[model samples]
Target: MIEEQGIIIALDGEFAEVRTQRRSACGGCVANGACGTSLIERLFGRRVTQLRALNEVRAGVGERVLVGISEAGLLSAALAVYLVPILGLVLGALVGTWMNGLLLNRSLDGSMADLPSVIGGLIGFLLALLWLRGYSAGSSKRPEHQVVILQRLH
Candidate 1:
């Protein structure tokens, strides 16, 4: 099971709204200094993403809780969130390359003047980012907690 720690923000009957912290894998990225993601995350601080879960534990507002989902669920969720954008990027690049080949009436050299290629790449990357945001927002369902809560710290 994949476990995440969060704080309960609201309780709506049998459902609890928990806000989870967003983490990036860029902590050890070699391009951390040049990566826009690292810069943005630092500027914005930790992202508080809300998720709805079963209120079986009777958690209340401001209570810290741990949510867990099955390993299979986590893998599937990640694939959906990540695969589409990658497909879009590859498709866009291919289209751009094809269009360039036809427009110039000749094959493009391995030159840096391919504006379409650059634009397509950017568009593909942005599309993926946008899709990820929506995917994350909608993927949160009634997650099952695998670990039993022995006691509340506070």
Candidate 2:
């Protein structure tokens, strides 16, 4: 399981929004003076990321608590998040390459080598963007008071 400490920002029935504290590795690093990370941190300060989770316990806003998700669940979620776009990209690339090869009058060596990659890359990028947008849109449609609880961490 992956665990982290977060402060509850909002409680919507069984779901809670928590913000995790951002940590800086630059302050204790030996290359603090030369690292771009340190420079960015100095310019922007620390950043915090907030995520929503299904609350199994009776946690309230402003309460500090430990949150955890199982490794299997995390992996599955990550795969769903990444695989859709990647698959779209691959499909786009293949289709683009095939179309380019068929439409261009040039020889196989010339057309296949040149236009296919460019068209494929463009199609892949656009498809990936669309997939990401759709995925994000679905996240907001989660039901109120319904949460998936994997486990609680101390």
Candidate 3:
């Protein structure tokens, strides 16, 4: 489980809206100074992330608490968000490439297959985004899918 400290900002029935500050983990990395991520970090700095957490601790507004989320859940979310689109992109490109060969062979003219490939990739990316939207909306209703407040903090 990945854990962080947050302050409860609001409550809704069984959940608490905890505001956690987004701190860059890249600062401690050896490649920080050499990467474009450093430039992005410089531009974005720290931001607050408000998340709904399972309020097992019954933490109230203005109370600090420790929140934890499953690492496996995070990893799966990463895989779905990143890999699915890439897989779609590759599949779409392959289909476009196949179409390019077939269409060009039949007509013996244009190699303007690049357009099809780009269009296919864009469609795949959009589909992945739609899937992600559905998953997030559905997952919000499941307690196990959300961050959990482990304990009240000082």
Candidate 4:
């Protein structure tokens, strides 16, 4: 399990809204100065993240607590969130190029295909987002995807 310490700010039945500050894990890395994330962090400074965690430890509002989620769950969620849309975009562009060739009988200009490609890419991206909406809704109900309060810190 991956864990972080946070303070519960609100309670809603069995869940607690925990607020955690973003910390730089790359602080010790030698390449920190060359990393895009490090640059962004330096530019924007740190930000806070609010998450809903299962109050299995019965932690109350204003209490410090340890929240956790399974590493496998986090990996899978990250993969889906990043990969699906990109795959859709590439596949859509390929299909659009094929359609352009088919419709224009392999026109010499080739530039005509650009419009179709853009339109196809947009459509594909929108479709992927729609699919993700449903996927997230279903996954939200699974215990593995949920963040849980591991223990009260103080």
- Candidate closest to the true structure, highest lDDT: 4
Q: What are the runs in model 2 whose C-alpha is more than 4 Å off?
A: 24-44, 79-87, 105-113, 132-154
Off by over 4 Å in 1: 5-7, 19-51, 62-64, 107-112, 130-138, 141-154
Better candidate by lDDT, 1 or 2: 1
* Model 4 lDDT on a 0 to 1 scale: 0.87
Tell me the tens digit of each residue's lDDT in model 2 across 1-154: 6676788889888788888877777768999769899888889988887878778777778878777666665665577577876776677778777776678754357445756766686778787778767766774454431233344444
Worst 10 residues of 3 by lDDT: 104-113
Predicted candidate 1 versus true structure: per-residue lDDT over 22-108, tens digit per residue: 667787888975888888888888777887777677878898887766887677677866787788787777777777778886765
TM-score of each: 0.55, 0.61, 0.81, 0.88
lDDT of 3 at 89: 81
Q: Tell me model 1's lDDT, rounded to 2 decimals.
A: 0.71
Model 2's alpha-carbon lDDT is: 0.70
Error of 2 at 54 (Å): 1.4
Cα lDDT tens digits, model 4, 58-142, are: 9888999999999988887888899989988877877777787898877436566488787778878888888888989888788
Weakest 10 consecutive residues of candidate 4 by summed lDDT:
104-113
Query: Total clashing residue pairs per candidate?
Result: 0, 0, 0, 0
RMSD of each: 7.0, 5.3, 2.9, 2.2
